[model samples]
Target: MENKNIEVKDENGNDDLYEHFRFLADKGQQPLRVDKYLMNRVENATRNKIQKAAKDGNIHINDVAVKSSYKVKPHDVITVLFEHPPYELLLTPENLPIDIVYEDDDVLVVNKEPGMVVHPGHGNYSGTLINALAYHFENLPNPAIINGVNNTNRPGLVHRIDKDTSGLLVVAKTDIAMTHLAKQFFNKTTEREYVALVWGAMEETEGTIEGHIGRHPKNRLQNTVYLNEDDLHKGKPAVTHYKILEKLGYVTLVSCRLETGRTHQIRVHMKHIGHTLFNDARYGGDAILKGTTFTKYKQFVDNCFKILPRQALHARTLGFIHPTTNEFMKFESPIPKDIQQCIEKWQKYSTHAEQ
Candidate 1:
């Protein structure tokens, strides 16, 4: 077998990381159905997900796309491809402050700040969470070759959120932890929750949004929902459940729980139902989408936007089974001052409007 180690993505596929896998069967491997075989092995994958991958022509054997029912034989070379590209970064450790909500021998939970990028990428080569990890810790287990370069100081990240998003992230501190924690995320057994400030007052107190999300054809930076059955090729399945926390007239504060973490699941799904995230520039929530057309109202919103320049979203909660102890644990982070202050302004404004 060439490689058996797997990397996973958030069930809601986070952007900046397209997830893929390669599995080489052992010389003495027994015949088994592809989906079943894959379900037992791959990371961030489920039997249904594998079947979907097969249907999307993303599952291959010897470079040939195959059905989920295809039986695996000894020495079969299996490849699973998503829009995911290799995200290995050569670490340049930086001295940065990180909020550690909880830390154990197996894992560490970080309350990441909004402006901090999770890892290094094209334009951002420094001041990343990965860079900070390298500086603070001796090493995190990652034996895979990184972008055809040196693999030293590589941090193991089973899943990541967007750069502008702030949240609780669980980091693997050892090879054993990485494997066990990855399985939790892959099986969709972990619990995650987010708080968001979205435009427009929601008519429903709580609801679920389901759609296939893929990269936008025209706008490379954006993702759109593929609602039609034929458009499934464009994206993977994503599901989010949301409930209104407060109705702030023009915008509503909502709590979102992800079922399938695809890239930009909350942002795209909220916008699809006509409620874009407040100040989410890329998704068109930067401007006043549902407010009175007046100088006072516009100025008030502009001030709120200045307070929270990025998307009004925060990952408030994360829960998973402990890799070593096998006990379930959950962590929560308080909303940052920016989002909190902005929400306060909205609350005051909406109250006056109601009166």
Candidate 2:
């Protein structure tokens, strides 16, 4: 058999949960499905996650990316990659303040403040939520433990919100809890709601934005929605249901419920529909998207932007079934001061415009 060499990368800078695994197939090895081979070698790994990695082109043989059904041959060098890295080198605990919303033996819910990264990556190696968790707790659970390859468990992040988005996040403390919570997220049974102050009034009070989302080709920092038949396959299916909560003339406050939790789903979907989240610089919402170009109007909008320098999006509500108890649990977080001030400013401006 000819050896195939393929290079795979997650160029979106989503390296927070990245895990790398490698194995050398024995000379006596028989042809076997790559998924099963990995399951046996990678301890504590879930079959679902293994197949998902394969589907994402993260499974490679002899440096060649392969599918889940690829047959493993003798003397082949197999490698698998994943988003969830083991807790070790990056577990530098920091004595930062963490707002604990709820915690029990099995899980811990945190209302992560905006501007705090969920985990360390790139240049941010400390002052992250994981760092805070490490300081508060001993060893958390990492669901994917590949025996000798990354056999460490730390705080398990079932789902993560953006660094600039303030919201509730649940961390699993046990293997069973991590598995259960991850399944819920994968099955799309978990409820996630965000409140966003977007540019312009929405034409529809309630609607669903259905599109495929993937990393933008030109702008690596942003994700774009694919609605056309030809381009749809380039991205993954993502659905977002939204409703206008308040129409503030220039900018409308809306609530978005995600059916599929794609990266930057809300930001991309809202921008696709011509209502980008207010002050979201990456998606071109930082400048004045709505309102008159008068100097005073520009200053007012600029002041609002200054008030909420980051994206005007907040993860307000989260609901899911408890991994251990099987009881439905819900969490709500208040809009932080910056967002609140921005909204109030918009409320007053809209009222004045109406008058």
Candidate 3:
């Protein structure tokens, strides 16, 4: 795998240096210290250069020359004059195996396996889906067009699934396809379905959950729904529909659909309904499925958990319109092996209980 050359152009056509200064000033309510702000905005730019630039009267605040300590206000415009640095893609491509469920010139649908990350990020710079795609599509035009402030590794990813959740994902190969797929997702025209083996038998066979989800105030890493109007973390509306496919005594196999995609919508909604997925550590589940009369089956369930590394949730299907042709496209992925084994063990245990 090799690193590719990439060019980052300021789409607004403003001077790069001046635009950077304006972006910092407008991003916050209070004025930013001149030396500190420039250092953060311009990568690898030296403090001496920044100070020199300020002293030379190359920086202006609200059309007037001001010192670095001058406070900024709302709608205030600040500009700085400086040279551009050589921009290059930081991530390199790597050869990794990917399951291609469906493919065409415009788009490709992948049945991603569990444990595979979608893109390279902190501490994970290789063996990602983006890296695999780069190797698979070596001749892709401008394969190195990094989004503004986004890493160069992921150029055509329209949507994402959790790294541990196995399922169908669509990747665009061309700009036209990318634009079309992005629009479908934005309009909520894309359909997504997930199959999960959730703990406890559901009381209701089918239902819909509607709520607003945002970052949890206490646990910054997780999202939680706010029930009050005064909550500072107001979230966007999310809707999820679910139906039980089968019930196996203590566990239920279910299918979920998303009307609005928010982070962890299905998982959170299920937890809200008091039916978290089996083996989901984040939500909570039975630590042990023991003490049952079916001793053999209980052992099987225990073994299943010991072997399975993540929650028993799978992205079963994805449907959307073709980005370039405007034609309907749909893809499905079978449940992964670990989840299937858990379901089988539950079925066996249920039959034993009946006897």
Candidate 4:
């Protein structure tokens, strides 16, 4: 990786620029709506700027300034001129040890530990899987498909796991593998299983939750499903099937499978069914772990107002077809130490009632 210094001006003030843009158009095609096209291109750019740039003739479609609504064709040279923002600290490869469960020329699987973020974002900029992968593979493939013109720093990442949720993740080492794996994910052909520790024993041994998930209307940062049918935002359809594995008094250990992957799908669905994961403060598990000794020693617990630092969810098993080899592969990760300890502690304290 290389470092460069640049400057950009935003609403706040003059800031360093650290953004890149790539255009995808073919010759003889009408230009794409500049603002509409750019909305998909730049992740951090403001809509106003993107629109203004197009209106001001700063964007060229096939070397010609066009209206924002101009249609674009393939192979057309689309050029966007914008100020780059300052480079911020992002996930950089480090020598942090990782448990590699499976690896081949096209793909690699690793047992991700809890507390380790899959990628870097707000408030977290280092020690991520991306950083570790960069250090581990000298010539690692860039997994990100440059969609339209978006430029993100993440590379070799096919899927993601939350920072606090530990699990097994597959990384694509080649473009063919990346494409094939992404298709499986998009088509929901891949099989994924998770183990979660939730508060309260399940009344039923097995059940399925189906709902639409979107950002919570009242809470900007949280995701929720609307009870009302007339809400404008139609949440994407998400399904999760769960079976209780064991009961420890009030808490229950369960395994879940996803029919669709949406942001915070499992967590939100579990909470919706009145069984929030143990120690999950967001939905309503805060009271469950109150005064529990498990929080005394864990740094994550100490730092938060709540006990659990991350959601008690783990991606336990993943099975998919090999994109390159055409072979079916399945990978599984055991529960991480922290989650295991939490389960044990709960079992020790809670007197097992009749299951």
> Whose lDDT is higher: candidate 2's or candidate 4's?
2
**Model 3 per-residue lDDT at 208:** 92
Off by over 4 Å in 3: 1-89, 139-153, 286-300
Q: Give the per-residue lDDT of model 2 (tens digit) for 1-355.
A: 1111212346554444343567777565678999987776553667898999999888878767799999989788888765555334546878999999999999999999999988755456678888898888876886443222232323677778889999999888887887888788888999999999999988898999999997675565678998787776557799999999999999999999999988899999999999999999889999888889799999999899889989999999999999878999999999999999999998999999999
Which residue pairs in candidate 3 have backbone atoms (N, alpha carbon, C) closer than 3 angstroms, thus clashing?
31-72
Candidate 2 vs candidate 4: the TM-score winner is 2
Candidate 4 per-residue C-alpha lDDT over 1-355 given as tens digits, one digit per residue, 9 for 90 to 100: 1111222343456553333344654232244565665564444556687678778665666556666776666565556544543232244579999899998898999888878878665455688887788789866555334322132456667778877788989988887887788789888999999999887768999999988886674454567875555542336678899999888766789999988988788889998987888766667665554334454424433433233466789999999999887989998888877778777766665653233
Candidate 1: C-alpha RMSD after superposition: 10.9
Give me the displacement of residue 333 in model 3, in angstroms: 1.1
Ranking by lDDT: 2, 1, 3, 4
* Model number with the top TM-score: 2
| TM-score-sorted candidate list, best first | 2, 1, 3, 4
Question: How close is every model to the real structure, measured as TM-score?
Answer: 0.74, 0.76, 0.71, 0.70
Runs of candidate 2 exceeding 4 Å displacement: 1-88, 145-154
Preferred candidate (lDDT higher): 2 or 3: 2
Stretches > 4 Å off in candidate 4: 1-83, 86-91, 143-151, 232-234, 289-309, 352-355
Task: Write down the TM-score for model 2.
Answer: 0.76
* Alpha-carbon RMSD, candidate 4: 8.6
Worst 10 residues of 1 by lDDT: 1-10
